[model samples]
Target: MSTPSKAKRKLRDGVADIASLWNSVVENHKGENPALQQRNLGMISRVLGILPHLVALMFTAYIVWIARPGSSLFSWHPTLMCLAFMVFMLEAVLLFSPISSVLRGAGYTTKRQWHWMLQACAVAAALTGFAVITTNKYMAEKQHYTSWHGLLGLIVCCAVNLSVAGGVSVMYPAIVFNMPVMLLKRLHAIFGTVVFLGGMVTMWLGLCSTWFTNNVHHDAVLALCFACPVIVLLYVMVQVGQKIFRRRAH
Candidate 1:
């Protein structure tokens, strides 16, 4: 009945109306029209697509800065390997991503060409990094592949080279006429994913190395660096797995 009481009631009603409108929006986003939901998913995927590129670039830069490639022969190992696996190889894999590829607008043939080219760069960097570490170890009269990081890195390097060789067969299925081209592609994707994950694990192990532990004093920074590979690995796996499964289903 009073003027102030009437104003308070009006304000409460206005707040309730706003809350109801917000709830409607949230519910609509959750389960609206099928097409709208699909579009929203596409948008989310596209946004997430940029994540790997940013993470890879930042992580590689951090490692390179810490390694200071020119400081010592061993320093080049981490620097080059980080660039190889984290940057080049990641770009190569993402080139085919339907949602987030920078070349999503390009033809499949164009994407394939760039894919192999990027992969070649990755292989070159990896080999050079391997050689650097080998020479450094030799100069110091140290044993090779003594640590988990060293052994895994050796395996990843060899596997990556082999995977690239297999890609040739995928590119030219006639070379392996016995196997279906589709099958070859699937196999290549699976093998490549495994090798990529191995490389990431090796990178993580490298982080655990005495050099990294001594150099990186901040625990939070160390934790974030550790997560870099994990995020990339999950993104790649999800993308590759979805493609493989969708193909199989159809």
Candidate 2:
């Protein structure tokens, strides 16, 4: 029998440790498929981990197409637009790789979460900006449309933007690495505030227009804008509340 190299041995041991932890903490989430069980990360977990980005990419493409020059979208500077797109592409590469999987096994520190949040922000901003551009184009095309396609597109775009913002708040809270705990916590707190404020402003605009002008589509758009802020606020509040309660009990 051939002996395995030292590096191979270390790699095997590391993977085994991760597999053991998965079976322990994750419990029933670990699937029964033998093939998956044998893998470093289970098939389902890997897919679920990557699922968010896959959805992000699809939305990214849709928003880009709608916002691109051929459509009624905003006129963007060529250099800045290319830079933004490149940034998103870079984010995708980082998020979907084996490196991310390795990081998960290593456990996420507050610093890591902060870094992750920053990367996610770049992705979200680029995407949300695209959505806003697309909407602006639709508005420019005409005040009204005879067919429902335009209206439907607007609704979908708004929904996607809100979803992007909300999901970003969720995942971003845990992406930074290698930072001082105190600093990380402060940044986390600050980011939550920023996201909440931005979401609220977006929602307010939609609501005011809908309420005063009787804008039906604006009402739908506003729902997404409003929901993103509310959901993230509730999530952070609950997390903070739990921590406080635990501290009091301790």
Candidate 3:
């Protein structure tokens, strides 16, 4: 085996970069958000940066806990949607985190590309999960599109697909249409927000669906799993809206 120097360097670089980013956000927001500034910068940075992943983890853990041994292969539907698609999509949305000079230096366009990449992965995951559920339903002799979850999933998938198309199309307003780029971007942002909110609602519905309620006996854990992400995502969605329209409004 070769020396671990390369891996070490990458890891060291990553931590250092994150530290620099954290400090930048702290220093930039120090005067703006006094509550965060007064607290330990390290703690603030970690929470803001790491909270999304932790939320994803807890969401998946609850599903795994519910779907442990002997659960239907059908469980993969909620499992994949929650852990892979919805959570990943939320992270992509949050990538538009608070605007700051630190973020500007971090490459605004690069971050947007990352957002696109994450959403693309999420779409693929959703398609896979859709196939799993559809096949499972067929095997189980269940009727096609019988439940609220099924209906909602279909609607959400269409909305997400359309939003994604709009998102991409808006990037080239001149090529796509004669419309102004700003107008196209504003429209894309609206659809994107709608799709995100819909994703959150659909996931919550899936969690509270008969599958989870019947399987997971733990009451508090279930409640916590549902509440935390709902609250967090809603808050993030609001922040995103303000960031988007606030600029447009001005």
Ten-residue region with minimum lDDT total, candidate 1: 25-34
Show where candidate 3 strays beyond 4 Å. Answer: 1-49, 68-72, 99-105
Give the Cα error of residue 217 in candidate 1, in Å: 1.5
Tens digits of per-residue lDDT, candidate 2, 41-88, equal 655557655543444344334334433544433433211232233233
Off by over 4 Å in 2: 1-41, 70-190, 193-250
Model 3, 1-250: lDDT tens digits are 3469887788799999999998997677757665655576657665766666676677777676677623667767777777555466776776777631124356768878877888888888887788888898899898977777688887888888898888788766656757877777778877887777777777777777776788777877778878865765765667667877787678
Per-model CA lDDT versus the true structure: 0.93, 0.44, 0.73
Write one digit per residue (lDDT tens) for candidate 1, span 163-218. Answer: 99789999988888689989999999999999999999999999999999998999
Q: What is the overall TM-score of model 1 with all chains considered together?
A: 0.84
Maximum-lDDT candidate: 1
State TM-scores per candidate. 0.84, 0.33, 0.75
Off by over 4 Å in 1: 1-43
Worst 10 residues of 3 by lDDT: 98-107
Name the candidate that leads on TM-score.
Answer: 1
